[model samples]
Target: MDFTFSTEELLIQQMAREFAEQYLRPATRRIEKENRVPDEILAGLAGLAGLDLFGMNIPEQYGGAGAGYLSYVLAMEQIARVHCGPGLILSAHNLGLGAIANFGTDEQKARFLPKAASGEHIASFAFTEPGTGSDPKQLTTTAVRRGDEFILNGAKRFISNAGYQGPLTVFAIEAESGVPTAFIIDKFCPGYSISQPWEKLGWHGGDVVDFNLKDVVVPLDNVLGKIGDGYPILQFGIAYGKIGMNSLALGSTLAALELAVRYANERTHREQPIAKFQAIQLKVAEIAGLYESSRWLCYRLGFLANDPKSYRDFAREAALAKAVVARNAQEAARISLDVHGSYGLMQDAEIARVYRDAAMGPQIEGVLHMQQIILAGDILRKR
Candidate 1:
């Protein structure tokens, strides 16, 4: 397999790098402090012709850039390298949007994709509930069928982008069949309301909040895939979601490596640069190794996503990649912090922010142990 990026891929990567450096880097502090991305930044990100980032993975027929998953991964890494908040927003958006793109009817695609691709609305996926932690069997949400609509009632927790005006793919159990199903509902509909945004440790501007659906009526056509197909749909969404998560972790690892190397060169120890120190050199080398390893794993996962042999195989690979990359990012960040010594502990330090962001990598999307379980199960089954 060739390791080189195509010319178009390189261009997309360069565009994303420039955008992150020019726009996101300057606003990183503001985003972190305010806990919100500026409307101008969001508009620029979506409206820019060469950098239609929100639509990278969407097909061209849906008014997206149609850059494919590899292009999307390249762009996400650059974006997250400067600041992860925007990356988080894009990742969660795609998590929901990918589900619809892969499973929705043409009519549903026609209705939802254009606006979402244009960033007039941001998409969200809802699966987790107060009672369920990655367990679909424990879902308490209920969907009751009526003449032409299904009335939904449930509470979703830790949902990202729930406050955004767009399509939200929600999972609930159908009352008649007692089977879980996925539904597409417009955000802030008559019976939809969101709680205050949850204060998160990192990725500040990427909003996460609790939301309630009280008799939220969804049209019959909005049922994604088939009735009682929520499990497969959920698996597909989570698998694709892991690709975004891996990209973010890889970016964080790269950032941490860069920060450590820069600190080593700039900080003087005994009237000489700290790079002269073997301990500092070793730490830098370790961080670099982590970055490189995580980078390839993330890129490979993205490539696999473009044309997977099977969803089960793709899901297994995604789990493996995330388990390694997320933990590597966290380890790299910790090593970078050690390189910074006491200064890293200060709130004003850049490495401190990177540390916090890296800390989230292993926890979000799926916990580390859960990823282990997925991969382990796959291996055991093969045996």
Candidate 2:
């Protein structure tokens, strides 16, 4: 494999780096303390939109930049280098756009993609219900057709990006077929309300809320893909979501590793820099290796996206990537904190927040064990 980024990819990565330094780095402390994102994603989204980014991985015909998966991943990694908050905001919005781009009718595309491309609107996806997380087969959200509209009734929790008043792509079972279907509903639709904001451990800058659809009305034209085809659409969307989340892992891990290496060299112990110590050396080596492994996995997933045959294989790989990178990043962050000694625990120290975010790795995307089940399924399929 070439293992080289294209010009576009490099440019986007550079842009992301700059975005993080200016917008994210300066605000990390405040965002964590205030527990609000300050509409943070909007700033980055507007900037990227100028570069024709917002829906970059989607096709141009769908009002995206058509920059390909690798370019998007490169940008996402850079943005995530600072913190998971902003990157997650963009990621969740993209997931909503991807579902529409991949499955929506031309009219639906014409209506939503243009606004999405320019960052004029953001989006959120709702799938996980109050009772269901992993097993979605028992989803109780039902959509019944009534003339030109569909009436929806259900509730979903742990939904990111739902705090925004934008288009929401919700998954519900069609009343007649009892099969999962997706619909695009306006946030202002009557009977659609988000539950009170939920406090979270990490990712404090972004919004996380529960979404409820009580006899919500959705136009039949907004149905994404065929009725009962939500399973595949959901899979395809989350496959990319997994890749994006783990890419954040790679970026955060890189930050942690860099911080540790720098701290080891600058910190003094016994009248000598801690870099002189073998223990510090081992920690740096472990972190660098782990980061490199997880990062390469992200790049591979980006490339695999170009090949249709690899998608089935890619889904399992994506799950593994999320799980591995989350674990690896947490380990790297812990060692980095240890290298900082007691200073790392101080709220004034930036690494303190990075440490907290890293500890949240297993919770992002999906739990580590659940992802392992996907890998196990792949193994059994091979047999």
Candidate 3:
């Protein structure tokens, strides 16, 4: 396997890196501290870079650039390297689009993909209910069929883009067939409302809120894929999404390490840069090693996602990548913070913001414990 970037991939990666440094880096700290991301900022990102809804893996026919998974992962890594909140929003858009690109019928694609790809309508996913996290089969949100439309009556918590006043891609169980299904619920839908803003420890740039669907009626044409196939559809999209999240964690690790190294070189102790000290050198080396390892694993998973035949086999690999990288990033952030000394903990410090964001890594995609157990179970069962 030739794990090398082609000229095109390199160019794309460079473009993403430039955008990250120029557009995202400067305001990332402010976004985190203020805990409010202006809608105009998000719109500007989408408009300027066309990243608002760039689903790199989706075909151009559906408004995507017809890029591959590797390109998508590389772009995500660059974006996350600058700021995780926007990175996550981008990741959610890709995941939501992937589901429709892979499974949605022509009508479904016609209705959403063009707008989703162009960032005309910011996208979101609603799977985790009030209590259902890992066990989605226990979902209580139900959709009862009433002639031409289905009445959706349930609430989803911790939904990204919850109050953004845009279309939302929702999942619920159909009452008649007891089958899980996906639907596009526009913000104008009467029963849809964002209840409250969720104050989070990290990822403040990404709007997180609780949504209530009180007898919201969605047309039958809005259903994604088959009536009862939402489970596998969501699972597949989430597996890919986890890869993107892992890339986010890896990118954050790289950023933290670079920041620490820079700080160490500039700060001197006893007429010598702290970077020259054995203790600082050791921490820097550790950070480099962890970042390199996690990054390669993330790339491998992205490449493996190209073919659907091996997707199931990649589930454990994806989960493991997310778990390992997230933990490594959390540690890297803390160590970087320590390297900065008292300044690191300052409310205005970027490292402090990164430290807070890093704390969220292990909990974002999937719980580390569950992922580790799943990896072990997959190994034992294969044996």
Candidate 4:
């Protein structure tokens, strides 16, 4: 696979890096303490929407940049290195938005794509129920066809972007057909309400909403793809989520790793830099190694995403990328803190926030163990 980036990807990377340093980093303290991303920053992020920073991989006809797969992931990695709120928000939005781009009808695309691409109307994915997250078959949410509308009843927990004013694409079993279907339920729909946002462990400053859909009425025009075809659509969204999450992991870890290296060199012992110490050297090496490995893995998956027939094959690749990067990102953050010694653990330190942000990567998009199981199965099948 070619490692070179096109002119567009380079521009996105540079622009995102500048945006992160100039705007996002300056507000890190406020974000970490307040756990809120201001609307202005979000709107600033929207300015890049035309560059596919938010709408990457979405076709140009729909008002996005129609970026190549690598461009999308590269933009994510750049922004994620500075802050988790925007990083995860963009990824989470794209998680369901990409599905709509791929599966929605012409009218549906025309109705939502341009606005969504411009970041005017954000989208959320509602799939994780109260007791079911990874296992969709156990979803208790059911949608019943009634006249011209589908009546939905169930609660969705840990839904990203639910607090935002936009449409949510919900996943539920169609009672009569016993087929899982994706329905776009507008925030204004009847009986559709969001519970209080959850206080998250790491990715804060953004909404993580719980959906309570009691007889939520959605028009027939809202269905994404055909009935019983939700699986592939869901999987596609998930694959992109993993892909972006992989970038999130890489971005945060690389940031921590580079900072640790600089700290080691600048910090001194016996009037000499700590870079002379082999222990510090080893930690830097480990972080570097993981970053390189994960970067290549994510890049490879970007290429895999281009082949429509490689969807399932890309599933395992996405999982592997997420699993490895998540684990390694955590390790990198820990070692980065170690390099700073007690200073890193101090509440006011920047690395402390970075550590917390890095902590979220492994847990989301399915746990690391699940990804490992998928990877193992892929290995066995190949052999």
Candidate 5:
């Protein structure tokens, strides 16, 4: 892997960092407190720096930067270090667009990719149902084939972009054939509704929509891939998405560590800087180790993403990266809070927000035990 970034990469990194410091960090607390990312704010941010365009891996022809995984990862890191909600929204939109750009038919690409890549139409991926957590094959949502339309009836709980507000790519099992399929369901679809609002432990500003589709009619042209082929497409898309999430978590943890180090160095302990204390030195050292390890793992995953054919073999690695970084982030946040003491717990402090937000990592996206199980299975298979 090349450690050097081209001039373009450096410029993108600097640009993203400035956006985070200027717009995202200033409003991070307000968003977390209100638990709402106003549509106007989202739109303004999308317009200002074209946050949606830079982090996307889609091609320039599709109105994106045509950047690489590392570029996206770096941008995600910088944005998430201050505010993961905006970062997640951008990531999900890009992931949805990436899925279609890579797998969709020419017409599908021409229809959906441009709007999504340009950030004119936000994209959301709906795969997880209440009945099916990690297993797509067991999805209870059913799509029945009609003449020129498929009638979709099901409920999707804990969806990222649930409201019909955003353009959606929904996955449901075709009833007759028992095959998973992806559909481009428009907001005007007859029987689609966001039934409930979900509040999460972290990432408060992002929407966690619950979709209820009752006799929803979707045209045959909306099918994302060949019949019975949506499972692989979704799996591949989510693998890359998880890598981006790991990058965000690692970046947040590093930011927390930096905050802690600064606090320790300037903080006075018996008329001398607390940096002189061996305990503070040890804490900083441990944080440095955690950040370095997580960052390297994220880079390795970026390299792996460059060649997707190798991803199947990397499921365990991806799961491991998610688990390790999630755990590392929470630990780092706690250390930062402890080092800062009272100041860290204040709502105005960045560490407090980072502490609250670090937990969004491990909840559903490859929990530690799940990753351990996968890693153990890989070990046994290799042995």
Candidate 6:
């Protein structure tokens, strides 16, 4: 098996690293303090001459770079290492974009993708509600047909990019069929309103909020795929979403490792560096191992995502990778914090921010235990 990245992949990875160091690294403090990414940074990420980081996975015809999933993952790792806010934004945006790309008709792609790819709009996927965390059966959202338009009513919770103007892919139960369906609707339409952003535990700049859809109108043509197809579309969107999530976690893992090693070498004990301590050495080794293992799992998942033989199998693998990588990132952050000792506890410490960011990976997308259940079910079904 060829384990090396191609030249193009390396170039994209380098470009992302440079962008993160040049732009995101300097702005990290502001982003964390303000809990918002500047519009200029977002524009640069999208409109930069050679670095269309925001549209890495979109097709070239859609005003995107079409760099494929592996390139996207590589770029995300670098972007997230400096700061996870941009990575989180891209991850959620791709979740909505992936659903449309995989399930939407040609007309739908033509209409929605160009502007989204250009970063003129940020896309969002709305499926989770206050009552239904990951369970689709408990969805309270309703969509009713009215002539050529559908009226939607529901409240979506913890939806990322909902506050932004873009196409939102929403899942709801149809009044006539009683079957769950997916619809593509514009955000901030006549009947849509969003709550103030929820102050989350980490990833501060990635805005997530609850939104109310009261008699939201969408044309029948906006129905994604077909009626009763929301389940598969949700599955596909989430499976791909895991790719971005894994990349973010892996980046956090790498950051934790680097911080631990740096702290070990720089911190002195009795005029000697802490790197001389066996305990510090062991902690650094553990963090390195976690970073390496998580890196390979994320890269493999990205490769498999490029052209999966079966999305069912792909989803299972994504679940497995996310479970391991997310846990590794959290563990790595913990170990790094231990290395930092009292300093890491300070709110402004960089390692402290990494700790909070890593803590979020296991909870978002799907909880760690939920991923375990998915893996267990897949294994038992194969048996």
Q: Compared with the true structure, what per-residue lDDT tens digits does model 5 show for residues 1-383?
A: 47887797777778778877877777877788787765654664543237654236877776766777767777778878878877667767766776787778888887777766666677788888887767886888889999988999998877775552546888898877898988887654678878655877777777777888999988899888888878887776776677777877887798889998999988997899888888888888888888988888887877677665665676767877887888899889888888898988887788887887887787655456767787788879988
For model 4, residues 23-140, the per-residue Cα lDDT tens digits are 7788877877787776666764444453456667778898877776787778778777887787777878787678888889999888877877777777788889889788878888
Q: Residue-wise lDDT of candidate 3 within 2-38, one digit each (tens)?
A: 9888787777788788877877767776777777654
TM-score versus the correct structure, for each prediction: 0.98, 0.94, 0.94, 0.95, 0.92, 0.98
Error of 1 at 6 (Å): 0.4
Candidate 1 per-residue lDDT over residues 1-383, each given as its tens digit: 79999999999999889888987888999998999887767775443323787777889999888888999999999988988988888999999999999999999999999888877789999999998768889999999999999999999999999988999999999999998999999999999989999888887898999999988989999999998999999989988999999888888998999999999999997899999999999999999999989989999998999999998999999999999999999999999999999999999789999999988888777778999999999999999
Each candidate's clash count = 0, 0, 0, 1, 0, 0
Off by over 4 Å in 1: 45-50
- Please report, as a residue range, the 10-residue window in candidate 1 with the lowest summed lDDT: 41-50
lDDT of 4: 0.81
What ranges in model 4 sit over 4 Å off?
44-52
As for TM-score, the candidate ahead, 2 or 5, is 2
Residue-wise C-alpha lDDT for candidate 2, range 1-383, written one tens digit per residue: 59878887888889878877886778777778776766544544445455555677778776778887777778888877787777777788888887888788888888888777767677888888878866669799999999998999998988888877677888999998989999998776789787777777776766788988888888888899989988888888788777777777787888898899889888897889999999999999999999899888888887787564766787887888888888898888888999899989897776777777777668756678888998998899889
| Residue 53 lDDT (model 4) | 66
User: What shift in Å separates residue 329 of candidate 3 from its native position after superposition?
Assistant: 0.8
C-alpha RMSD between model 1 and the true structure: 1.2
Q: Compare candidates 1 and 4 on TM-score and give the better one.
A: 1
Error of 1 at 86 (Å): 0.4
Q: How big is the RMSD of model 2?
A: 1.8
Candidate 6 wrongly placed segments (more than 4 Å): 45-50
